[model samples]
Target: MKNRSVLVSGASIAGPTLAYWLSRYGFDVTVVERAPALRPGGQAVDFKGAVHRTVLERMGVYDEICRRSTGATDMVLVDAHGNERARISGDFTGGDVEILRGDLAAILYEAGAGHCAYRFGDSISTLRETEGGIEVEFENGPAGNFDLVFGADGIHSRVRRLAFGPDEHFVRHRGYYYAIAGEPPHREQSDGPRRRESYAHNDAGRLAVGSGAKAQQMYLFAAPEMHFTDEAEKRRVLTEKFTGMGWQVPEMLAELPVLDDFYLDALARVRMPSYVAGRVALVGDSAYGNTLAGFGTGLAVVGAYVLAGELAASEGEHIVAFARYDRIMRRYAKVGLGSSPGPFLAPKTTYGLWLRDRFLGSRWFGLMEKFAGDAKDDLDLSGYPAWEAR
Candidate 1:
């Protein structure tokens, strides 16, 4: 892969992770992000299953993740009345380990700190695959030629839009509209819905709190089966949905007027027939993303592995590596994002959510625990050619 240049879109999880591995495997890598810089904390992401661990270990960040992880011990299911229904320990949750999404992104960025070219505050405006190589022009004004390009630019990827026609063709609506913003307050806001007294293993269990940070904090809001085309539409729908939902919601909505980092969108997934399209390939959420599936992290880590390993195995030949990258990554993404167990976790309908809480939480709790205990067993990370480059 010497002298072969690659431009990965979005410096989020997958792009940085892939950049480190590709750089290690002898590919010149550059990651571009629309964000001005590595975004600060907003949401918490979990890492479950053995593959997550394997990838982190390989990247040499597993210990760091555990070190900086939010040890959320117990999860209490409460109703609109704040009445507790059931309690689920973090262990019973396969991906129980949770961390601020920004922290994880920071760890990934650190991995390629020096080796990879990081161009922040910009993104790919256009990508053209020519006879000799792919000619790429960036919004930040960088022009270059790359043997191949990968899009890890999250759910709404420009590369995917440009490479694979309009997003409507590949985006499968998952029948839900999710949104998260911080709760506005005076000062000293409590952590929203704490799993226990302390975030650590508190079996005795106490009520969770709100964000105990400074007031005017970011909060989260989600509505189901809403309509929206873009960011403004999403905000309007959110405003319409929670106009009367009480419990400081009005205050949260009031903050919405000034909220800049509002993550509002219909819960959706990309159901591409295949990830590979010409010399451009899609990775992470751009390829397979089922927000309801709860495998965004898994799909991302696995995709990085496939992309790097395939490139190394194929030497510098973009064709062979690109093809094999598609072969391995598509299957992993399918299993991780299209699995059955996920919708049960974040069901869209009342009935489906009831099934999860009642059947899984009540009478079948023991069975569910057993399955969760063995959740990592289904992962088959075999046949991946380990590349120790000469």
Candidate 2:
């Protein structure tokens, strides 16, 4: 292999998965994460179709993932009176299997940690391409040069900013924002049966969902773009958007201040002509993210597999490998383009909400599910024998 040393930004799903494959293919891989440690328990993410299952099986984590899987939970849409108006099956939302984002990250991290170097609580400060390779400067650690770098750092990726351009040029806000707030760390669970159904209450442009135990809360609302400087701002924005809402919303908001795990971000999408620029390439959300579009995690895992396989197949010729990676990923990721789940989840008009409810209850919803499954399996995945033999 010509280019054996590589750096991957982000320790979440995509970065660690990429690190695992690259190291397995005999390349020296280093993963950099901004967080001090792996984040635990935010929201549930799922994998669908044969493509996702195949990649998991290849990585040898399929059995473990299944053991840790949180079987799909059905969602019920309810009115302020606490009457259920519509239901969305777990099969439709949760796909083949579902797991918490935190758990999946830990699984990928552990699988790669034995071979790949990990630097947490640090992030890339700068990137300069030299005649030999790319020189990278870190926020807290010493700088180093590497043969290649990848941005798997979500939509607002620091690596993307340094190598590509500003956020405005690539990330497009979809006029909606979503937030997830969980129970404080080590909180005791109430004595009762675990929540099997999640209830959603929507009012015009806002939606609030709460589990049976109220252990996790999710909110989605339509709004113009706004930049929040701190957690306080995010809390305030979330409160303002759903204050007048009914159902269990008031109680959910009341617990926000005490919650330790709180996340809020705009529903955005990434648009770029190519995933590669010189020696730097992007994967996962940094490449083709459409927030809550239901394909982000699946695309990220599959992209990592393809990228590492291509590099090993090409004998580490990044120019050839990156071009192939970009071409394949762009086509497979098209399903996530030009679509946003914001309006569907929290419609801006009463009629829109009614229409959504009707659609969910109609036969067409089945067809929609079939279409999604097909889109996920659209790729003709190449069997890179170099990695396969190992």
Task: Give me the overall lDDT of model 2.
Answer: 0.89
Q: Give me the overall lDDT of model 1.
A: 0.67
Q: After superposition, how far is residue 286 of candidate 2 from its true place, in Å?
A: 0.6
Clashing pairs in 2: none
| Candidate 2 Cα deviation (angstroms), residue 87 | 1.0
TM-score of model 2 (CA atoms): 0.96
- For candidate 2, the per-residue lDDT at 279 reads 94
lDDT of 1 at 149: 88
Please report, in order, the local distance difference test score of every candidate based on alpha carbons.
Answer: 0.67, 0.89
The count of backbone overlaps in candidate 1 is 20
User: Roughly what TM-score does model 1 have, to 2 decimal places?
Assistant: 0.82
How far in Å is the alpha carbon of 219 misplaced in model 2?
A: 0.4
Model 1, residue 370: distance off in Å is 5.3
lDDT per residue as tens, model 2, 1-390:
788999999999999999999999999999999999998886888899999999998899988787777777789999998999999898988888888788899999999899999999999999999987999999999999999999999999998899999999999999999998875112123432122578899989999998744478889999999988999999998998898889988888888787778899999999999999999999999999999999999999999999999998888999999999999988889987867999999999999999999999899999999999999999876576446676
Per-prediction TM-score:
0.82, 0.96
